[model samples]
Target: MYTDALRAEWTKLRTSPGALWSVVALAVAIAGLSALAVAPVTCPCATDTTKLTLTGVQLGQAVAAVVAVMLLGGEYGTRMITVTLAALPSRTSMLAAKATLVGGLVAVAGTVGVGGAWVAGQAALGDELGAGAVWRPLVGSVLYLVLIALFGLGVAAITRNSAAAVGVVLGLLYVAPLVTAMVQDDDWQERLQRFGPADAGLAVQATINLDDLAISPWRGLGVLALWTLSALLLGGVLLHRRDA
Candidate 1:
């Protein structure tokens, strides 16, 4: 039954034109932005090359969020969720199927985007990137985007509204970082930077200046994972309790 539900969700996503295009857009945006960021670096000393090369993840995540939201929220908007629920019966399995599909799709797109960004960086920056520098950001960037997409799916499941879910996820990703920057207290600023979803998650891209970061790379990614998990848990509870 669970496998069947997964197949149904996968099939739905495969058939949706918007979902298909959004995945492509995610890859393109990440690669393009990373290349653009790399092209401007005349002095590598002024920038963290690893972070610069993977900068596309910042913008690419927005598209991932949109794709996740639309996958479930589109069904709600079109009154298709009711039919989905009727067919699946078990809301838990249905939500799990959706999350699994969203996570898998985002992972594939992220791998392409991150791989493209690394190739672009190598072309623009040459041998500046060391052997130790390559693997973490490359692997972490892929995980970062997958987590962001799951975060979106969780939010959409809770809200059951595409527009609201998109807005909240964007604000969490983009605006929270800005608000964290504006804090007068250095301690609070540092704390927020350590925990804020975008700030913490993006820390995974920093190959150099590890001591200067507010949080460790893996730990920062952990913060984002916590946020994603919390949202999904709340969403699952609400999804189980509420009607379609």
Candidate 2:
């Protein structure tokens, strides 16, 4: 039954024009922005200039989140969710299948986005970084996109409204950066940057100024992962209890 449910959702995603377009748009937006950010500046003093150049994850994440939210919310908007639940009968399996599909889709798209971003970043630097330094940002950026997709899935599950889901995901992604800017105290600003998902997650790409960083790069990405997982769990619980 679960297997069939998974197959069903996979079929749905594969046939959907929106799903295909979303993946394509996500790759282009993330990779293009990353390239633009990295192309003009060479962080000569930084050993891990790869990370600095690939800083477009800050903006690309919002695009991925929007895609993820639309995946589920589109069904709700079209009144297909009720039919989906009818076919599966178990809301748990339905949601699980959706999440698994969303994760897999994001993982594939993320690889493309991250790889493209890395090449752009490297070319922009006009210097070949050590393999070890280069791969971290490349890999971390992929993980970042996956987490953003998961975060969007969670938000959609919670809201079941496309407009609301988009709003919530965008707000979560963009608002923190703005609020961090508004803080009057330097210390608080730094703290917010260290703790905030965007600032913390981007830390994984940092290859320079380690001592001056509020949070280590990999650890910052971990913080974003934690946020993603927490939201998913909350959405899962709500999904289990909801009437559908």
Candidate 3:
């Protein structure tokens, strides 16, 4: 049953023109922008260099999240969600299937985006790309995009409106950092970086300065994962409890 549902979800995604174009746009934008961002500078620490090179992930994630949110949000806008729920007859199972499909596709596309970014950064920045310390940043970047997509899915499930869902997801992912920048004290800024979702999550891509890093690489990724999973669980609860 799960496999059948998965196939059905896949069919829906492929038939949607937005899905393919969004994936292509995401891959190109991330790779191209990251290469440009790191082209001019070299860092003493490899981690810093890697971080600069992967900066595009910070932007690309929002795009992936938007795409993910649209998967469900579009359905709701057109009142197709009711048809979907009726056809599947198990709302929870249908949502699970949708989430799995969206997550898997986003991960694959994100891999391309991040991989292209890493390679382009290496070529454009040379030593600035950070030698052997590349893998974590590369893998972490892909995971970051995937997580953003999942986060979006959860937001869309709860909100059920394309515009509002997109707004909520983007606000959660982007606004916190902007607000954190307004903090006056150095201590407060560092504390926020250590705890904030975006700052803490990006720590996974750090390949150079471990001692100075605000959080451990694994822990940083875990923080983002925690945020993503919590949102998903919350969305699932709302999805099961609310009307289609």
Candidate 4:
């Protein structure tokens, strides 16, 4: 049942009218902003230039969220979800299939876009960086993108509205951290930094000051994984209960 659903979802996603274009948009958004950030940097300085170039992840994630939202949300919009539900029967299988496909596709596109940014970062430095230095940021950024995509898929499953899902995803990504920043209490700030998805998740890019970071790099990624899993579970439960 799961394999069949996976195949069916793959076929549907591949034939979606906007699928190819959306993937292209994601890559371009990341690569374009990253290249722009890399262009002006005078590297080999006493700062984390890798993180600076990775600023594109901030803007590029919006596109990733939209692509994922549109995957299931488009079905809902067209009332094609009814057909999908009927064909699959098990909602869990259906959602899992979609999530797996979305993760795979996003990972590839993210790597291409991030690879360009990394190369630009290398050239800017006028010296080659060890794999140790480059691997963390590069791998973390790609994983971050994948989680963003899955997070969008989960939210879309719950909301079932493309615009509303997109709005909610973007709000949590961009606004939660903004609201956290307004809190003046140091302890509260640290707590928020550890919890907010964007705040905690982006910590994976930090290489310069590991000890001084509010949350360690891997722990921050764990915080994001928690957020992503919660959304997926809630969406899955609601899906199992609600009528399609």
Candidate 5:
């Protein structure tokens, strides 16, 4: 039954006109923009190298979010969710199927995009970065993309409106960093950085100057995981309790 539901969701995604473009865009945006961001740097720019690779992620995540939001939010908007629920009967199972598909697609896109960014960054640089140091960041980057998509899915489940969910997701993801940046206290700023999804999740990309960072790499990712899990659990509860 679960396998059948998964197949159905995949069919819907493949048939969606703009869905292909969004996945492509997610990859292109990450790799393309990261290359551009890191193009003019030299060897000593190690920290900058890792940081700039994230330009793609910052932009690509928005595309990823839209892909997830449209899965359920778009259905809600068109009242197609009723048809879906009637067909499936178990909202939890349906959500699990969709979530699995979203994570799988995002993981593939992220791997390609991160690989592209790694090549582009190396080509644009004056020298090679240590492969040993970069591998963790690369792996972490792909996982980060998957988490971001799931985060968007949870928000979409809660909002149940594509327009509103997209707006809220983009606003929080983009604006929260700015709000964190505008703070006057360095200590407080660092504290907030440890909690901000964008900041902490991206911390896993750090290869140099680890001691100076607000949070350690793995722990930062754990923080984002907490945020993602909370969103999913809350969304699941709402999906179970609320009227379709």
Candidate 6:
């Protein structure tokens, strides 16, 4: 049953032209932005090269969120979610299948984007590429994109509206960081940076200054995972209890 559910979700995604193009757009946005970021750097020493190379993730995540939100929210918007629930019957299996399929697609696109960014960085940065730099941020960046996609899926499931879901996810990713910067107290600012979804998640990209970061790379990722999982769980509970 689970396997069939997964296959059905995959079929729906592949057949949707918007979903297909969104993945391509995501890859292009990430790689292109990373290349642009690398091109301006005359001195690699002045910046965290790994983070700069993966800078595209900031924009790419927005695209990922849109795709994920549309996966479910589009159905809701069209009132097709009723048909979907009627077909699947089990809300848990259905939601899980959607999450899995969306996560898989985002992971593939992220791999391409992050891998391209690394190759671009290597070409542009040349000898400045640290021996330890490529692997962690490369892998972490991919995971970051995947998590952002799942995060979007969860939020969309809760809101059940494409526009609202997109707005909420974008605010979480972009606005939270700016809000963190506006805090008057340094300690509170640091705390916000450590806990804020975007700031904490992007911490995985820091290869140069581990000690200076408010949260360690893995722990920062953990903070994001908590946020993602909480959203998913809340969505799941509401989905189970509510009428389609």
Model 2 TM-score, all chains together? 0.90
Error of 1 at 198 (Å): 0.8
Q: Which residue runs does candidate 4 get wrong by more than 4 Å?
A: 128-132
Better candidate number, 2 or 5, judged by TM-score: 5
The C-alpha lDDT values of all candidates are 0.91, 0.78, 0.81, 0.86, 0.85, 0.89
- Indicate which candidate wins on lDDT: 1
The estimated TM-scores of all candidates read: 0.97, 0.90, 0.92, 0.95, 0.95, 0.97
Per-residue CA lDDT of candidate 5, range 183-232, in tens?
Answer: 99999999999999888888888887889999998898888888888878
lDDT of 3: 0.81
Better of 1 and 3 by lDDT: 1
Clashing pairs in 2: 200-220, 203-217, 204-217
- Runs off by more than 4 Å, candidate 2: 42-48, 128-132
Per-prediction backbone clash count: 0, 3, 1, 0, 1, 0
Model 1 agreement with the true structure over 1-244: per-residue lDDT tens digits:
7898999998888888878999999999999999999987765465688888888999999999999999888999999999999999988899899889989888999999999998998898887754347788899999999999999999999999999999999999999999999999999999999989999999988877799999999999999999999999999999999989
- Per-candidate Cα RMSD to the true structure, in Å, reads 1.1, 2.2, 2.0, 1.6, 1.5, 1.0
Off by over 4 Å in 5: none
**Candidate 6, 95: how far from true, in Å?**
0.6
lDDT of 4 by residue, 145-222 (tens): 999999999999999899999999999899988999999999999999998888999999987768887898889988
TM-score of 3: 0.92
The per-residue C-alpha lDDT of model 5 at residue 53 equals: 63
Note the residue pairs that clash in candidate 4: none
* Candidate structures ordered by lDDT, highest first: 1, 6, 4, 5, 3, 2
Question: What tens digits encode model 2's per-residue C-alpha lDDT throughout 1-244?
Answer: 7788899998998888877888887777768887887666745654566665566666677777877887788888998888898898877687778778877777787778777887786676665543346667778888888887888888898888989988887776788779898999999988998878777887777766678888887888888888888878888888778877
